[model samples]
Target: MKVLVIGANGQIGKKIVRLLSPTNFVRAMVRKAEQMPKLESLGGYPIIGDLEKDFSYAYDEIDAVIFAAGSGGHTGADKTIAVDQFGAIKAIETAKEYGVKRFVLISSLFAGEPEKGPKSLETYLEAKGRADDALINSGLEYTILRPTTLSDDDPTGKVSDVTAFGKSSVTRSDVAAFVAAVLPEEKTYKRIYTFANGDIPIKDYL
Candidate 1:
């Protein structure tokens, strides 16, 4: 499988590129030229493309896509809409145009119910929800992973599909592992689920 990982330089994105590169060809979509070397060293075939600009150049010969890109909290609402919402929607369109078989999205836990999320991040959450809707309506195979608040702790290699795990957190590495594990599984191709660190083994879910 040849996979293209958008926002390949982010915390979870980098891990996805690393995990997929060993088993699948990876096109790590990075924005800056300086990020190429670091991503390449992680076994990814670094491809330079900005989400805020043209990214179609990076979709050539890609078999699948993982949209892990985000504008983050510090960036204002406009950048968030530009990168997270429209950027992800464009990626799905590009995947359809390029005949990519699967599209996986890295979304937030309360994306589908943003009003219940942080008030300050309401705009960002809405963007995610809209982007998720775009992918669902695009008529392409998709997997949407809505993880709870992320943590940097070492991975426990365990996760569960628990939508009501209040204040629960998941490690970035575990999320990446989960994405890599399920991409080839047809059962997960069209499902949208929430995951968090839990006693259940991650592999069991896949």
Candidate 2:
């Protein structure tokens, strides 16, 4: 499968590229061309693209796309909306225009449910929530994986089968693994699921 990973320079994005490059035809999108060498070294076809701008060129010949890119720890709400919400929406639209088969989004936990989250994270969650809602109803095959607080720990390749959060945290690598695995599965298409490190079985949810 030919996969395009937006935000391939992020912490989790790098891991996803490394994991998918060995088997799939992976295209790592970066804002700058200089970032190409590292991803290329990892057996990825690096493409220079920006989420805040036009991404029509980036979608050429792409089969699936992983919306893993986001604006980092910033203070302004506009930046968050621009990068997280609007940027994600743009990517999805472009994917549809290009006839991409599957779209997988890396969203955060408590995205659509603001009442259960802290006040500070409410805006960020809302932005992701809006994007998730848009994709869910976009009439294209989609999967939204909402994961709890992310860590840099390695993946155990063991996913919790449960959908409810029970005071558990998931590693970033595990989230990336889940996104990679879900994109090719028709069973997970159009499903919105959440993930964490707790001992809940993910197979039951799938």
Candidate 3:
């Protein structure tokens, strides 16, 4: 399968590229040309493009697209809307235009809530929520994976099958695993599910 991975240089994006490279043709999209070398090293075809701009060219000959890109740690309402919300919508539209088959979105927990935690990042979550909603209604075959508090820990290579409706935490590696696993499976299509690391078995939840 041919997969187009946006934000291929991000924490989880990089891991997804590594995991999918062996069997799938991956087009890694980045904002800068310099980042291409690292993605190419991972057996990905690095394409320079920006989420804040038009990416019609990046959608070429792609079977699936994953919007793993985000505006990192920077806080601002404008940046949040641009990268998180608009960027995702743009990618989805482009994918649809090119007749792409599947879309995998990495979203956040507590995305649609109006009340922000005392220490929670509000703008980012709000933007993610909006984007998630858009994708859900986009009439596309999509899978939305909402994970909480992303960490840099190693992958467990296991998923909690339990349905996580509320807030929780998980690692980037696990998130990438979920993205990778869901792509080739028809059972996950058009579903909106959330995940977290816990003692529960995935089979129990599924």
- Candidate 2 lDDT, 1-206, residue by residue in tens: 99999999888898899989888999999989889899888788999988777878988888999999977535588988888899999988888889996999998888877667767777788898999998987888999988877777776666654443446678888887787778778999998877776554445446
How far is 28's C-alpha from truth in model 2 (Å)? Answer: 0.7
lDDT of 3 by residue, 5-33 (tens): 99999988898999999999999998898
Error of 2 at 79 (Å): 1.3
Candidate 1: Cα lDDT at 44 = 96
**Model 1 over residues 126-199: C-alpha lDDT tens digits?**
99999999999998889999988888999999987666535689999999998888788888877887889988
- TM-score comparison, 2 vs 3, better candidate: 2
Question: How accurate locally is residue 99 in candidate 2, as Cα lDDT from 0 to 100?
Answer: 91
lDDT of each: 0.88, 0.82, 0.82
Tell me, by lDDT, which candidate is best. Answer: 1
What order do you get sorting by lDDT, best first?
1, 2, 3
- Candidate 2 TM-score over all chains jointly: 0.91
Of 1 and 2, the candidate ahead on TM-score is 1
Task: Compute the lDDT of residue 196 as modeled in candidate 3.
Answer: 81
User: lDDT, candidate 3, residue 177?
Assistant: 80
Cα displacement (angstroms), candidate 2, residue 71, comes to: 1.8
